[model samples]
Target: MDLEVGDKVSLIIGTETHLGFTVLIDESFEGLLYRNEIFEELKENQRIAGYVKNIREDGKIDVSLQPQGFRNAIELDTEKVIEAIYDHDGFLALTDKSDPEDIKKELRMSKKAFKRAIGSLYKQKQIVIGEEGLTLVKE
Candidate 1:
């Protein structure tokens, strides 16, 4: 079967293998959703909306549940976005590069969302982005 890129499809999580896990794209081909693409918490028999990531030379096709236009689990904990911004001392400074991405991962927010939150803090004078990581200006 031929699979085109950017094709929106829903898949059911199938067997988890050492090399990669399988997704039942349909009755015919079982796509491989590698560990890299499976960033968030995923369970066996979970259904997910995905895009046709690519087809490998080894005949293993891949799917990305993190495809564009997909809503993440972050919305479930919107308050964490607030906490990441506020707890990180308002400014996600240069030194905070690692934390920002990590926070986004744990918080399930995109880097853009993190930046926007910091921007809001900056405008409100709650914090400042400078040479160091976020500084608690409110103190």
Candidate 2:
């Protein structure tokens, strides 16, 4: 197979099964996109970008919508949270203590990712964590 782990590819969303969503990768190979890894809404036949996560010995491929690796994940999530904060008038009703589901519903990201982004923002002094939630630090 020409595709290797971390290679960016095109994906066509397929059927949802007990495991996850089946996908056609690069319109050639079949791959599985796990439910837990997916953060956004997807529909059958929808085309999207993905990265090859793994290739099993049995020839099955695993795909992910987001690029893998610590730095990539943190950067993407951090940018997403910053944009959401700006869109919400510089205030967000989310904190480290917020429910995971609520964080996902509000930001379409996992709570772990949300926390990392917020933690980074706090360290950068770009935002403030308060009793009610988070607020963008005005310059």
Candidate 3:
């Protein structure tokens, strides 16, 4: 395989299993995208971009919908949260305490990602974490 960890590739969504969705990578290699790593809806045969997460010694490959690495993934998730806040009129009814599924439905990101983004925003003074939710801090 000509792929390395973090390498971007084209993916065709395949069968869903108890573990996750199987994917055809770069139209040649077979890989698995874990269910727990997925946040958005995916259909069979759907085409999407993916990143190589790992390659087992046995030749099995692992893939991800988002770019690998903390910096790449966090930036994207953070932007999503910010956009959600704006879409909800400067207030997002999701806090660090929000359910994982709710955060996934609202931001299409995992709870860990949401918390990291929110924390980043808070440190930057870009948003306020309130009992009700997150409020955008006006400039």
lDDT of 3 by residue, 1-139 (tens): 7899999999999999999999999999999999988989999999999999999999999999999999998889889989999999999999999999999998888898899999998998999999989999999
RMSD after Cα superposition, model 1: 6.7
Ordering by TM-score:
3, 2, 1
* Backbone clash count, each prediction separately: 0, 0, 0
> Which model scores highest in TM-score?
3
For residues 62-118, could you state the per-residue lDDT of candidate 2 as single tens digits? 999988888888899999989998999999889999999999898989999999999
Q: State the local distance difference test value for candidate 3.
A: 0.94
Tell me the lDDT of model 1 at 122: 62
Strongest candidate by lDDT: 3
lDDT of each: 0.64, 0.93, 0.94
**TM match of model 1 to true structure:** 0.53
Model 1 residue 9 distance off true place after TM-score fit, in angstroms:
1.0
Candidate 3: worst 10 consecutive residues by lDDT?
Answer: 70-79
Candidate 1 Cα errors over 4 Å, as ranges? 57-59, 68-96, 99-101, 109-139
As for TM-score, the candidate ahead, 2 or 3, is: 3
Find the 10 residues in a row with the least total lDDT in model 1.
69-78
Q: TM-score for model 2?
A: 0.95
